[model samples]
Target: MTAHTATTLRSAGSTGISLPEAIRRADLGDAVALLASAKKYTVARLSGGRLSVPGKGSFADGAGVAGTSTERALPLSTSGPDAVFEARIFNKDAELRWLHEGDGLGTAVVLSESPDICRPLGEFLDPLYAVEQIDNRYLLWGRPLRSHDSGASTGPLSTGPLSTGPLWVRLAEARIGLLDVPVSRAPRENECVFLRTVEYVTTEPEHGNAYVAEERLVELFLAPPEQSKAAGSPQPDRLPEATR
Candidate 1:
């Protein structure tokens, strides 16, 4: 009875030899499904259909291919959560190493032609330091030059006043011309603002293994406390300050 059953099974297997080819041929007709997985897998067009499977799944088993995909071609997702997490840990470790073993901060001398440009710097180091000029540069003194019920810091930057705040002052001194607005919320006129920002840009998954790197540029803007302002109430004769 066992021999008879084995013979029957062998016959069935022999007749089903064309089954794998038939399945592969049918799969090739649906090109969309194959292209959909292209981001996560190394998809290549075969003679009849496309090959779409996981890194571990064998093309030979599914598409009746001869060998597995190459190592460089298989891992399409090189920068996943795991890679990013590892990169963060690596950056932290590097910072800690620098803090422990790197040379500490050192003082440097920056000679300026005029003291007007460098005067507000003292206020950053010591908020109590008094600033003398406050006409257009009220924001540099860390006080609102003008305000409204809306509570917006400054009017729309384009039409807002030009105070020649710290950045503009420095840029003017250095003769640097910026044709475009550098900051997203660039301070208008007299505001002295400090901002720290990070931006990450990634390519589409169809591009295959992602390329990533951390690049940073630190630019600091410092200002002062209220300068040339005195405590006083407006008399009936005097007009109130303009709040645009």
Candidate 2:
């Protein structure tokens, strides 16, 4: 995954139309085309209950009951009802469930940030997209490498470095010292640290909102490596420009 290689893959068979741009113009054909051009991610074509992977075996759906149907989604995994894909995001692992409809046209992309839900039993999708049988949609799934640790709670319950305000080497969509607390991590030129929020505020304050002092440090998500490289190091005052 060198810089040159990544650039070459992105330029390969490119139509000069990005996914967001195609969606903005309401161009389904261009969007599908752009998605198909992506070389790094898995892209499959579905037709007549058969899924055709470019360099893999074609899978046929199994027997089904009345309302629910089983899909033989071997591209993600084999001999299981679950389909998971793992991708590196923000230098850490982010997992999402790859669920498909009876026809395998519609997919439910669920983020795996919770542990209570079994990895096999997935949840609903966030920012779901629709694609025809001929179109290709990006899939994401699987539990994080540290699945033994629970990701469901946002509170800093563990008395490890997490509660002691670990130093942050990077950040995204946030600024240093935004929280009303003492900043002890003496961030470098572009680095920051986690801070525990002493109070919490809720929206709809005009109506009725709870005011409590919740001792917890909100989650911090880092930017993707590609985006970080593109934007360069972030300044203390501003975050890096978002990439499409």
Model 1 stretches with alpha carbons more than 4 Å out: 1-98, 102-161, 167-207, 218-244
Clashing residue pairs, candidate 1? Answer: 163-189
State residue 64's C-alpha deviation in candidate 1, in Å: 74
Tens-digit lDDT track of model 2 for 1-244: 1111100000001123222221222211110010111132332222232332322111112100011022233243321333322211110112222222232222322122233321232333332121111111111111111111324222221222221222112122222211211112322222223211112222344865433311111223222234333444333334211111
TM-score between model 1 and native? 0.16
Q: Deviation in angstroms for 12 in model 1?
A: 69
Which has the greatest lDDT? 2
Candidate 1 C-alpha lDDT tens digits along 130-165: 111111211111222222222342332233433341
Q: Compute the lDDT of residue 236 as modeled in candidate 2.
A: 34
Which residue ranges in model 2 land beyond 4 Å of their true spot? Answer: 1-91, 95-118, 123-186, 190-244
**TM-scores, one per candidate:** 0.16, 0.17
The lDDT of model 1 is 0.21
